[model samples]
Target: MTPSRVIGYVRLSRESADSTSIVRQRQIIQSTADSRGWDLVDVVEDIDVSASKRRLDRPGLSRVRAMIAGEEVEAVLVWKLDRLARSVVDFGTLLDEGINVVSCTEPLDTTSAMGRAMAEVLQVFAVLEARTIGDRLRSSIAYRVGQGDRWRGGPTPYGYRSVRHESGDGKTLEIDPSEAAYIRQAAEIVLAGGSLYSAMQAIREAGSKPRRAEAWSISSLRVVLTGDSALGRQSRHGVPIRDEAGVLVAPWEPILTVEESERLRAILAPRPLTETRRKASRLLSGLLVCETCGSRLRVNSRRTAGAQVESYGCRANGDGRVCERPASVNADQVETFLVDEFLAVVGALPVVERREVIRDVAGIAEVEEAIRHVTDSMREPGADLGALVAQLGTLTESRDALASRPAEPTIEVVESGETYAERWARSGVDERRAVLESVLTGPVPVKAIGRGYRRMDAERVAAPWAWLDEAAADFVDPYWTD
Candidate 1:
């Protein structure tokens, strides 16, 4: 008789600490198939997948099912029955589907009444064992957290890696030197009053790779800078775990101190959106205004003789309003004139950096809400009282910490030791735009000038400084005339 065609299935759960390896399972299944004179067509596996997962959640299992449904295989062989399905419901579903499942270790003759009964009993025991293991694991994790141990089970925070503890009992997080240096530089950039976007650019230029993504995302960078893990504080689900005395439990080395982390968080906190649309990438985006219709001029570019030439014009605004006598100016000419006039007017002024020391009270209400949730859960049946009590202690500590902070903001201004001109020379476009906003009350209005003016007509521009100078001249002229 021709050997029966069969396909072998194997699975290894992520939490199965003592489960058989995929290689061992494959060896057993292959040996069993050889002994039974079966033609083993293929061996499909789901590694690091839970056996309790539904069929749709397991790609390898789904493939096996599809093959069986197509009648391409006579029997599906496995190293053991539990590796195929951990729950009796799943096992019974497979039986009801008339799947000829053959376990290498636990052979079941499902045609016999006694065989079906034994299979059901074995499946029941498998489910019970899975739940028991899950409970034990949860208890172990909770005990570890309570004892001031950081959980390194999942992905370690950026700039850190899990290493075996000195006692060889479990894993502990240690700073990866290369990645930590990048983090330190990033923190310095942020603390020095630089935007997160600037820090991201610096990291990318230095060839620093993030933990997962090809480059750092704004959200990921914020987490790296402001996360409790950066300050060596243990936390779960973004809430810091506190000890019995309401102090945060930190057991590993830190990339930043508590003060530095707080300051970074303050600087990076979300602010209300403003109507300002001038990006740092553009030099004169929000500065120039059309003299005719008072609409902000937009940058327009054209390819001229194998080169791109940019100009600012107020042809039409977004509201469908077009200037009857639209004004246009060369970008380079206007930029140069503005920079020169700006520096000649206020270049000697000193640059002062203003820093705001803000106390974060945004998450206080959130902590209180979480405390209420945990309290409500305690009244429910089968609630883990020990775990819930521990959680409450941490939440209370967080609330106390937030409540102790002063509500008023403290402002500090220090000299940057650079003149306006000196800073302008070294600053980016966005920085220059900020300087213009500080000195000017509103957009600089440009008079309607025809195209092809090689030099910037100083009379055609009505900058704030020019207006002030002209007013002073008029005041002195009236006195001289009388």
Candidate 2:
């Protein structure tokens, strides 16, 4: 007799305290699999993801669907029916796919009429529970807003902190500073017809780092300038709300003055939708160059017969140049090749060597020490101090000028290994992007080949030398091979 094919599915809502904690879900699924005498083929888990019955953002659910479509699995086991789905529509669709679902804790079996009815009822309850939780959160937020309290959640925007402030009841809520000097500078640059990129550079030149140790980017600076707290206001759905309206209010401490806020807003208010399209086009677009014309390749995406296809092509040949290259290369294929090759390259290096290299290069304390020494030298008094001060002022002016400019194009390497993966998991997307840029040297080149496929021309660019690179490559090469 063949063993029953079973795949365990687990989903946790981001709002739930234990939604994505693997230990709890794994224990429950493992116990159930042990009792049922079913062969567990795979375990799909998505963390900090929502179980929206009306939505399909759950990665675990998508995995399950793929398993069923490929006929790779016969049945799916879940801790409960709610684990499988929270929406009646999604539940019905899953049943239609003919994959049996078993809820270990609930009397949910898709095989029988009574079981199906019970599953529907359970789904209704789950949806209701999800809605109730959402409503409660919103209500709590509204209540806090009515009291003129700010919700201090997520990372505090750059140049701001969640600090205790005196409330009417003598409790404290987090607020920004009265003269958000960095924020004001950012606004001034933007209003003076400076680009957002330049404004961020200016902020950095002024020796201003984010509340976190990370350098500021245009996106981060934009978030700060447009943030409700920066404007000394509170907002919900982009609409400014008053405390009396029972909407969540930002803790009132003026950062940028009203005039500054208005000026920044004016700069951001108008844009052709094409600007966004152009930006989307340029993500990783700069990584590829036409071998013939040496022009950067452009990315184009379109839907064909319910499937979307993306390709990179030479923009220079649009006017009818005899370019031997194909019109485009498959973007998916290009990405997959790059990712696979990149991973292979990474895996080829010894973990210890990589760590040592990272440790040697990422000497944050050393950089800080250099900054301190420079600062100290500027502060000391002597006859030569006057001349030194002038030099220091010139350096400061240069640094500030550089800071106010947009960042130059650069490639960064992201350290990989168990430790690096753990840190990446905890980091925000922007933070991760910054870390990647810091360690990798780039102008990552892509070459289009046959049938809309592209390969990364790894030879064209050099990898950033970490401390490990400083050591003899011969010593590291032998260990890596062994």
Candidate 3:
């Protein structure tokens, strides 16, 4: 007589499960199929996968479900019902679909009413066992974490090495200073007003190893700086199982301080991953700010004199009522100024400075200018120029207030192996912008005074940090303001 075709399904939740276990399950399933005069049309095996994951995420289980849904097999045979699903509800869903289930280890089968009832009861037991095992595992880990014990298994996070426990029971993670240096540098860069992109450059300049091959990359540094691992916290499957109060469950020391890690998190929380910048044509493309109106100076290009010309311009002052700054500064002209100014200021500093430079240039006036500019537009203009006159008065107040404020403290930079000129020449646009950003207070405000309009003067170019610290303030009265 011909045998009925069936689908053989096997699952060993852990990939580390012994091969003999799989052979035994297959053998038992085959033996039962033969005795029942059934032939397995196809055998599906899920190795190293867990019922803990969703069924769709598991390839073998998904294939088996699809097979069953299509009614391609007369019956589903497994070593045990738990091999199919740890959840009884999931198993019941199969029975509800009018598909027959048979387990080689259990005496349960869907062939008869009594057998079907036994199968469901066995599934219920299987689910209960699975849940009990999960609970016990969670409890064990929580206890281990609460006790401040090291992780017994698994890979340690980057920047840390693991050593066997003193008792030889497990392993503890220890900080690897060489690797830790890179992580600390990343955190400091972000805290110093540098973006993740800047961190990538600094790592490259430091000759630090990247998680990826060759030079450093954003995704690599991102996981380190923006994760709890940097804070000496441990996790698995990207999930935080327990906080375990008062316990520092990390077997290794962290690369960043608790405060530094918190600051990075706060800064990173609101910003989307898409915030990474793409390559731009000019060096200071988005870095330029209008000290006058508090608007970012945009790089606008136009076709003039039969060639493409690019310059930085402000949109708010298009009406020419709010700002006293220049209408537009030449792109090549500004970049030359930045490169020259960068060399003058940063060039004199030591070649290799400290691991981190402090960023203290305040944009208080710039921020206030931004707010005032927006608020001034709230009122409807009168038939006359009253609103305009009122807004102009507000702009003058901002300008005068900013002028009266004391000089901002200079950004102190230590020597890094290379001079600013060398680094600037070697770096890309984003990196150059980062170096410029770390030192400059806000945007390079361009004031058009008969003040050497021909040559971009540094004094008129208002940088928060001096080009070389008080070179006889050369423009107004004895202050020699430009």
Candidate 4:
């Protein structure tokens, strides 16, 4: 028989730093090929890609598939069966394609029934191990979260620099003053009613750049305004949550002050009616229920002179008594109600207190350096993996110990609502709106109340500036406010 043409395939997940190093995998493949007197046809590698247990996404696997389809290779070599595939379906497909697989490190060969059984068993173990790894990672993140530590592994948000704190015992992460100043300024701009575009321009004019050369955008400004973490609050799976007593809490250093944060929230709160109309126009235009024939309502833009008005009405208006509410109500009136109701709820919040809670949480960053130091030690070369794991265990224990420590409670109160009002006064329109939306309830709901009026429900609205409904009732015009 001609010398078996052996092709090597390797794959690694992005989350792992050293799963499939090209040099290492290539060395193993070359060594195995040399020992077996096999001709190495090619080496294919997939870096930073996941091998789904049910589906393989490895580029190397794809190349192997192509080679098999083209009848170019006799056998495929892999570091292990798990590296080749985790799914039985994929394994079956590979077998059906008439390409044999050999594991250099394991006694696995697809040619024999016994070897195939072994491959199946190995695949089961691989899937189990992948799930175990995922669980462990989630547990690690949850543990860090419980300790009020930032779990998302990436650079700090813009307008803030991750600083290392070193002391006699260990190190931690803190906020860099220079970058934080920019964060504070951004918050101020939002609270002042500045537009997101203008605010971005202002940031650029002030020589402000995101941590990774990212361009400033309205969405980015909205993220900053709504990010409780910047104010030293913890965001659990993207939703901001409060402490035991419904108070904002942080897992790391705060980039903005409580006052500034509250002000920003007030500025970004949503206008329910206007938001509803906009969304309805886009998604539910002809799909809305008529409440009469139960038929879908067709959206209509009633125009007077040069201005256009929008509303939803029955699709069959001339269907006689079958249609219940055939007349159109002013969309503007409904939008106004929503805006007022949303603002009212948001303005009722104690923004200053919430900000202080965030501040206290940020103080925990003083311990982040210690955590990082330990984390780094565990990742060192030739390091005892077990010892590093033990160190992580110890760090977790220490964190719990610190959290259990008791402290005196002293309330720091702001003078009045005027505090935020003054801040808002200083903010630009766009910035103010961004701040408002960040703290407002997700979206306002509008229901038909009476002719030319609608009931707006914003019971879920939770912004520091919700109290502003009373102060700015006339400013409820969504389209003209900006």
For 150-203, candidate 2 gives per-residue lDDT tens digits of 542444544455554455442333344432787787786576455788778767
lDDT of 1: 0.77
RMSD of 4: 16.1
Model 3, which residues run further than 4 Å from truth? Answer: 1-3, 16-24, 55-72, 152-155, 167-171, 201-220, 234-252, 266-269, 272-301, 305-307, 311-414, 423-482
Candidate 1 residue pairs that clash: 280-430
Clashes of each: 1, 9, 15, 38
Q: What TM-score against the true fold does each predicted structure earn? A: 0.63, 0.48, 0.59, 0.51
> Candidate 4 lDDT (Cα, whole model)?
0.59
Q: Residue 180 in candidate 4 has what lDDT?
A: 68
Per-residue CA lDDT of candidate 3, range 93-125, in tens?
777877677888888788678878998888788
Q: Cα RMSD to native, each candidate? A: 9.0, 23.8, 14.4, 16.1
lDDT of 1 at 429: 71
Question: For residue 57, what is the lDDT in candidate 3?
Answer: 61
**Span of ten consecutive residues with least summed lDDT in model 1:** 473-482
Runs with alpha carbons beyond 4 Å of true place in candidate 4: 1-3, 15-20, 87-99, 149-155, 158-173, 251-253, 257-482
- Tens-digit lDDT track for model 4 on 398-448? 566666666545545443343344444445434445554544333322223
- For model 1, state the Cα shift of residue 34 in Å: 3.6
| Poorly placed runs, candidate 2 (over 4 Å) | 1-3, 15-20, 149-159, 163-179, 188-198, 210-214, 226-228, 242-251, 266-482
- Highest lDDT among the candidates is held by which one? 1
